[model samples]
Target: MRAERRSGSLMAAPYAAFLLIFAAYPILFALVLVFLKWDLVTTPVFAGADNMRMLATDTRFWRAVANTFVFLSIHLPLQVASALMLALALNRPLAFRSFWRAAFFLPVVISGAVVAILWSNLYATDVGLINGVLVRIGLRPVPWLTDPSTAMPAIAAMVTWKNVGFYVIIYLAGLQYIPRSCKEAIEIEGASTWQRFRFLTLPLLLPQTILVVTLSTINGFQLFIEPYVMTGGGPLRRTYSIVLYLYTNAFAYQKMGYAATIGVALALIIGSVVFIQRRVIGNAEAL
Candidate 1:
């Protein structure tokens, strides 16, 4: 018994050490850094809650939070509906099913930086593919990233388009788990297609719905690469995300302490929002 226990401990020790070095230490140090000032060039000096205080009152930080919520409001529903619809459409027996699935998922496997760059051209106001289409349809070209009102939503839409393929795969996998008997029974009970989906298919996909909401919400909060590469958090700072703001603080402003504070606050906000969303969704499921 002693030898077995010792052997298990030896086997797990490397992973435990790795976690301590990579995860635990960084987390602890980040928390500590939130109270101290350091720019990597100057000596670290303890500021003691100043960073937190500044972050709490910073209007720009609040604006970033508000912008994130705006992005999510548009991104989340669009993502869920688009993914679910595509999943539903592809669920039935269709020609070249694997090919269709692969095509849809191709964008998801692409790098975010590449996606952002690709979309930048597609969204350019004067020479964009979107603008060209609008002009061909006799409509005025609209500035996607150049207008404050449209910039964030444009980014949200691009993100949705980029990630919908991944979530489609998710919903597709969820659709498979739904019992065929349940679907057949609903149809036998004289339920319309909409009713069947509303009652049976939708309810059964609760876990996937929860996953989509949580993952998309976290992604919305962490939006940096898209805005950074595309808009540079520009067009009146409409697309400025929290992560972008944090990066600006750390790199440009040399406010490492405040950046860590933003990180901590972001983590807390994400955790709380996801918790509330789960509770709400769970209660809805129960009802």
Candidate 2:
């Protein structure tokens, strides 16, 4: 038994070493850096808890947090609903099925920078494809990225469009696990289609829904490239995100300590929110 245990440890040694080097060291150093000021050029100086204090009271940080919530509020429901609907539609036999799936998923595989640049032109108020259609229909052109009220929502919509395909794949996979017998049983009991979905389909898909919510929430928190390339976190900073603010602190302001503090805060906030979301969803499922 001891020899077997030793062999198992030997087999896992490479992964353990990699974890220490790549994961453990960075985490430990980040915590250390949260108490020291460094610009990646000069000697680091101890700043104590100033970074934590500033992070707590920073209006920009709070604003970014609020903006992220706005993005998530719009993105999460739209993503889940759109993906689920598409998965249901494609669940049936259809012509060019692979083509449709590939088209939807193509954007997800493209680089974020490329997507942002493409969307910048697509969202241009005067000559945008979207606004052009609106104008042709006798409706006024709407400011998508220029107006603060619409900017975040517009980005959220775009993100949903980009990522919905991935979640559709997820939901499609979940749909397969649902026992056909259960669905047939419900149908034979005089249950309507909506009732069948509500009672049979939706409940079984809870795990996928939870995964979608958690991943989208994390993605919302880490939003930087989309806003950075498209709006530069502007038009009243409506699209600013926590990671963007963290980058500004470290790269632009030379505030390593504060950046690390922001990183820590972001991790805490994400953990708390995900935990609460799971609890709430679990409770609803129990009901």
For model 1, the superposed segments whose C-alpha errors exceed 4 Å read 10-14
Q: Could you give candidate 1's per-residue lDDT for residues 224-287 as a string of tens digits?
A: 9999999988888888899999999999999888899999999999999999999999999999
Worst 10 residues of 1 by lDDT: 231-240
TM-score result, candidate 1: 0.96
Relative to the true structure, how large is the alpha-carbon lDDT of every model? 0.93, 0.91
Please tell me which predicted candidate would have the highest lDDT against the true structure.
Answer: 1
lDDT of 1: 0.93
Give me the overall lDDT of model 2.
Answer: 0.91
Question: Where in model 2 is the C-alpha error above 4 Å?
Answer: 1-14
Q: What is the lDDT of residue 201 in candidate 1?
A: 93
lDDT over C-alpha atoms for residue 17 of model 2: 100
Q: Please provide, for model 2 over 177-255, each residue's C-alpha lDDT reduced to its tens digit, 9 standing for 90 to 100.
A: 9999999999999999899998899999999999999998888778889998999898899999888989999899888
TM-score of model number 2 = 0.95
